[model samples]
Target: MDLNQMLSEIEGGNDEEIERLLQRYNSENNRTFTFDQKEESLRIKLCQSTLAVLRREVPFSCQRTCLETLRIMSRDKCVLSPVATREGILTLSLSQNGLQEDNLSEEEERVVVEALKCLCNVMFNSPTAQQICVDVQLAPVLCGKLHSADTWHHEVGLFTLRLLFLLSALRPDLRMCLRKDCQAVTLLTKMLEHTLDINWWLTFTAENNERVMEALKALFNLTLNEPEGEEDVRQCRVIVSLLRHVLMLKTETVEKTEELHSHAVNLLNNLPVSCLDGAGRPACASASENLKVKPEIGNTMRNKLVRLMTHVDWGFDIMSGCEEEPRPNPSEDMTEEQKEYEAEKLFKIITELTRHDMIRPMVVRPDGQLGSLEDKLREIANDDDEANNSDSD
Candidate 1:
């Protein structure tokens, strides 16, 4: 049956029609499921029917189907206006009581996950929905959900982290609220450590990797453009340490490993220089060695020096080898422009690393089998000069 017919039947209290429609929609390729602007009335009717189904006591399967359908429909901005209303947001946002309880059945959990996914799409595509989220104080509620141990589930935590990231990214006021008021930094860092299994041992399963990546993205958003206070610095230290572990994790493929590292590096770039003492330490040895040594400024600076030098060396290797051995897969290769951009980011980071007293020696070390930071910087400068000369010619 067509969506119009199914939705009409749904409004007539035939919940089974919604499930059939949902199955049909799910079977079709999602890319083909566009909600055209011309179909505004149909979209509105569909939204009303779904929300109505959610408001009434229906089978959990029916509710989930309605929510899942809405989640797909909300991807289109044209359909979002009707779905972004206060009533719509409230109906879709999982009930605080339901989320708080640990004994929820699998069917009930599926409904909650679908609801959160729907909210994510709504918040992502509509400013109206974002403001409504704030008006309803959704950020604190999400934080509270994460804060409670009972409410934790893999899918629930992942989507919740995603929603929190969107709120922090889209709204400036909520960043501080998430940071100071919600204590999101500490909470997210703990989540990352848990996913990484940092305390017990490193565990790099796909599920945990995805959760850690979302937590990292959210952390990057939360810390963006915010000045670090003493408390913030302390929290950042713990995060950087966890991120160090993230860097060392070997995923199933080289590309996946690089992707994870890229996220880790982006977050590291935002952190304060003081907090980066944790970043420079050897990822594998950090947990044990940290327990053995009392942290001092000298040791911290030395670690930073070694870490910066390591980055410089790694950057040099990539730059030198890019031409000698072209990657077999053209799609996987970094473009020259992208390589240059990454090089610029590295230069900026290395430059910042040099501001400390201990980092100076590493930068100026003489070129040899173990190349120095100065040599890498000089090589990068010569390459830039050659590129500029060629462009001018």
Candidate 2:
């Protein structure tokens, strides 16, 4: 049937026809299903019908199919305007009422997962959807759902984390809400520990790794532009410890390790520097001794920070030495812009480390063989002066 005819039948309350049309559209192998941009009215109608089906007391199969179809359709930004509405968001979000109750059957869990997937797609593609998500206060609801241990092991938890990441990344207000209202830093930290199996023995699997990555990303967004209140400082200390564990994780490959470490670094860079006094110190001697944290974990973190500082120093040396080498085109591996950005983060981190009386000794080893942090800062200042002089010339 044509798109209009199918949507018409769905609007006419033909439940079987609606299920068939949704299945056909949502099929992975069905390459023939494509919605024309001109048929926007039909798309809106389709979203409305699917949302209605989700709201109705439909069978699990029907509800699942509707959610899956909405997920696929939401990929097109054009179809998202209607889906981004307040009512539309609530209908899809509330479809998983079982999630709030912590008593979902297997079938109900499937529907909830699909609903979350749809919500993720919608929120990702539409800023309107993102704003509406904040207005509807969906973060607290998702946070509440995440409190359940059962949700952590399932796709529901993963999608919920993904949604939270998108929401916080896109909406600054939601980040504060998550950090203050949801206590997301601690929640996500616990989730990270759980995913890494830190309490027991470490279990390195692809599934847990992705979960860890998502949790790290969400934590990064939550901590961005955060003020350093007493509570924030305490929370950051805990995160610094968790990041040390992340750096020490054994991924399947060197490349995977680097990728995960890059994310961990980005998050570590976002944390307030005041809380970093304990970053380079040993954790085993502290109160966490009861947790059996290895002493080397702290050393690993220290070494990682020093390596980044050294990398930044080396980059500056090369730039100063090769004054005549025409700046090369930005490459996929590390663009010139990205190099400067990374160097800046490393410089700031190292500069902050130098302020700590104890950390300064570890970070600034002045044996005359390695340049001190002060020397690097002077070199950076000289380079800036040279750039300004060259621009004036």
Candidate 3:
């Protein structure tokens, strides 16, 4: 009936406690109560509530039943409440600490799997849940859980799968580590293919076709561009599918074009030279030199970003002022070597404009572990030793 009652029951394992609290919280009499009390009481309910008791109370003491219940909720709730949800997931994570063989009890494992299923949906669907993943040691601990079978960690796998697939592009920090793990790409590739399955489609009952497409887009970004692996060429072909879909949308107007463009840039900014075939070569002409630029990744990512930002135009300027008198055309007088040097410089300008902020959300700054983009550009310059050596013995 009150906050104290809700906490006591939830802690004592009264399965019906959360719903009763929610029902009471939503009732006419409850409207007069202070928001704080209602919010406070809800947190306690969520903290104590397990997945097994979503809309029902405990029917048995068996752990398997409890685990199964959690899974049911995972398939049910798209938006989990903030109060209990965070604690619910952490508590579920902690439960694995009790495993005898360093793996969860089958039922306990199910609790985590379903709980994460619910958590991932909220993490992506609710802004608050997204914050909680970062705020409460969720991501790093998740990384640790993914470290081994001792983690016998299953749910976190699903969570990481969603996080890596959806959040990797927006956050560069995550991108670097995702590249560290070999399984990151393999798991994502497998999941992306699963999207075609009817079983996978049915799992997204609460998610509409648009959200599904966005998920597909995010998944492509993770696989196609963020990480370069043996499968990159194949993945690129699959990723190209998105370009056609977005272009075909006659109903998609300019309202979200800016946001979409930013996403597009994020996708393209990471495109390596390897993605380019004969046709894509011009689009990826700078990539051969990029490998020379990136020495070590972490130490240089931000620096690479800087160099990219400096070289690429943000498309903010339209007018160029000329103060010098026009010079005579010098093609006749210039040496072949000199002419080649100027032509190389022109290509760098084209490369920068093609990948600039106006076209993509690439923010480049200079300095750090990786060599600057300018340095890479210089290496790719026609005057670089590689170019000169290829011309002779």
Highest lDDT model number: 2
Candidate 3 lDDT, 189-280, residue by residue in tens: 33434432323323222222233344444544555434455565565555444432332232234434333433434554455545544423
Residue 123 displacement (Å), model 2? 1.1
Segments of candidate 1 deviating more than 4 angstroms: 25-33, 95-97, 149-151, 198-203, 226-228, 281-393
Q: Please give the range of 10 consecutive residues that has the lowest summed lDDT in model 3.
A: 314-323
TM-score of each: 0.68, 0.69, 0.38
> Which residue pairs in candidate 2 have backbone atoms (N, alpha carbon, C) closer than 3 angstroms, thus clashing?
none
State which candidate has the highest TM-score.
Answer: 2
Candidate 1: tens digits of C-alpha lDDT, residues 172-213: 788988888899888888777666774335436666667777
List, residue by residue over 1-393, the lDDT tens digit for candidate 2. Answer: 367887777877666777887898778523534567787787788888788787787788888899888887887787787789999999888886455446667878888888889889888889888888888888888777656634454677777888888888877777777888888887887777666664334535666667777888898898887665888888888888888778778676766766678788889888877777856655543553332222223446554444443233322343222123456665558978889998899888887876774454323445434545666788779999999999999
Cα distance off (Å), candidate 2, residue 310: 9.0
Error of 2 at 211 (Å): 1.5
